[model samples]
Target: MHQLEADALTSPRAPSFIVTLYGDIVAPRGGVLWIGTLIECCAAHGLSEGLVRTAVSRLVSSGRLEGERIGRKSYYRLTDMAEEEFEAAARVLYAPPPQPTGWLVTLSEAETVSTDWLPIGPKAFIAPRRNDVLRPNAAVLSCDTVAGIGALRDFAAQAWPLAEVGAKYDAFLSVFEPILAHVWEAGAPPGPEALALRLQLVHAYRHAALVDPRLPEAALPEGWPGGRARALFVRGYLALTHAADQHIGLTFHDSRGRLATATAATELREDRLRRECLA
Candidate 1:
C-alpha cells in the first residue's frame, strides 16, 4: 500500500468507513451497492469480508441501511432516514465555504436546545445562521456583532470547543496536504487508488468539518485552519473526481449492474465544488 493510503486507513473501522463510502460514492450514484463491491472496496481499507458483512448487518439493524437479495447476491442502500442524514451531511461536505450570515441566538427557559445549538448560557444557545440549519423555536435574535470583536471571539471560544476542532482541522491538513502535492506533481492516481484517496479525503475532512461550529470570521480565533482545510479539500476532490468516478463506474455494482458514472446529482455537486474552487 502507498504510505498515503496507509495513513488514510489508520485505525480503520468497518461501519463508519462503509458509511463514508456510501455517502461519498454510492449515495450519489443511485444509493445502491452490491455486497461483493462493498467487500472489495472494504478490503482495500484492510477490512475483512466477515467484518464487512457484520458491519453491514449492523447498519441494516440500525436502520441506516436496507438490504435486498437478488439471486445469490446482496445489495444495500441507505434507508430513507439515513438518506436524510447523509443529504444534510453532503451539503456541508461538498458546499463552498459559507459567507458570514451572523449568528442565531435562541433563548428558551422551558425547553432544552438541540445538540446542533451550542449552549452559551442558561436557556440560551447559538448557531451559525445557514439555510440548511433549521431554526430553533424560541426567542431568536440575529446578531451581526454581539460585542467587541475580541470579546465575541472569547465568548465563541468558551461556547464551542474551538481548540479541539482546530486540532482536528490541523490533523486533516497533515494527512491531505501531501496527497494534494502528489496529485499536483504526478497527476491523478489510478482509478481504484483515486477512488480510495478521494473517499479518505472526504472522510478526514468530514471528521473535522462536521464538528465545527462554523462561526463567522470575526468570531473565530486568529490563524484558524478551517478555511485552509476547506480549500485543500475542494481542490483535491475536484482533481480526483474524474478518475474516481471512472473507478466507481467500472467497479461498483448493484442488482442493476455497473453504477452510472455521471448523474445530474453528481454533475451538480461537481459544479458547486468547481465554483467553490474558483471562488
Candidate 2:
C-alpha cells in the first residue's frame, strides 16, 4: 500500500510566518511593534528572539533596520537599503516568466492534504469568537498527497476575485503548475530547501494578488500584473490564500450557520466545486 508521509508535505507555517513578520516590521506606526504583542508571534511563527535579534542586528549593521534604544526597548525602522532589499524581494516575486496563462484554473484544484496540517501561529482563543478569527484546523492543510488537489482548487477561486483578476491570475497559475507537478512526481517530502521555495512562492503570490492599495502608499502598482512586481505579488498571494484555505477550511463568507442544514450541505457541494475549479 502506498502511504503519504507527513514530511512530504510543506511546513504549513513557514511562508505565512515570514511574510507576516516582514509585514509587522514594515507597517509599524505610532511607535508600536505589532510583532512584539504576542508570544505566538515569536513561538508559533518560528521567530525565535535569537533569530529576530540576529536579523535585526544584521539589518542594523548593514543599515536596513535603524532604531534607537529607549531605556530598554529597541525600536527598529527601515533604512534606505532595507527598503531596496524589501522591494527587490517583492519585484522578484511578481516577475513574469516565459509561460502562458492557461494553468491558473487548473492548478486551483490541486490539493495539499496527505501532508501534515500544522496550524499557523497559536489558535486564536476568546470568550466570544471574533468575526475575523479563523476557525481551528479549518484554514490549514498539507499538499503531501494527491488528495490535497481538490481542496487547493476550492480555495483559489474564493480568495481571489478570479473572474475580476483574470489574466494575471492565469499567469500566476502558469508558474505554479510546474512546481506542483514536480512535487507530485518526485514523491519527495519537503526538506528545508523545498519548504523554503514553497514559502517564497506562496508569500510572493499573495502580496501581489491581495495587497490593499487602500494601504497608505502601498509600494506596488495599483492593479497587479501590470508589472513584474504585481505579477509576483499575485502569484504569492494565491499561494498564501490556497495555503490558508487548506489549513482551516476557511471561507471569507460565513460558513457556520448553514453548514448544518441539509439544503446548505447540498448547496455546499456546488459552492465547493466553484471554489475547487475556476471553470
Per-candidate TM-score against the hidden true structure = 0.92, 0.31
What is the Cα-based TM-score of model 1? 0.92
List model 2 lDDT by residue over 76-100, tens digit each: 5556665665554443333322222
Per-model C-alpha lDDT, please? 0.86, 0.36
Model 2, 132: alpha-carbon shift in Å?
Answer: 39
Winning model by lDDT: 1
Where does model 2 exceed 4 Å of error?
A: 1-20, 23-42, 70-72, 95-236, 239-279
Superposed by TM-score, candidate 2 places the C-alpha of residue 130 at a distance from the truth, in angstroms, of 46
Location of the lowest summed lDDT over 10 successive residues in candidate 1:
108-117
Candidate 1 residue 265 Cα shift, in angstroms, is 0.8
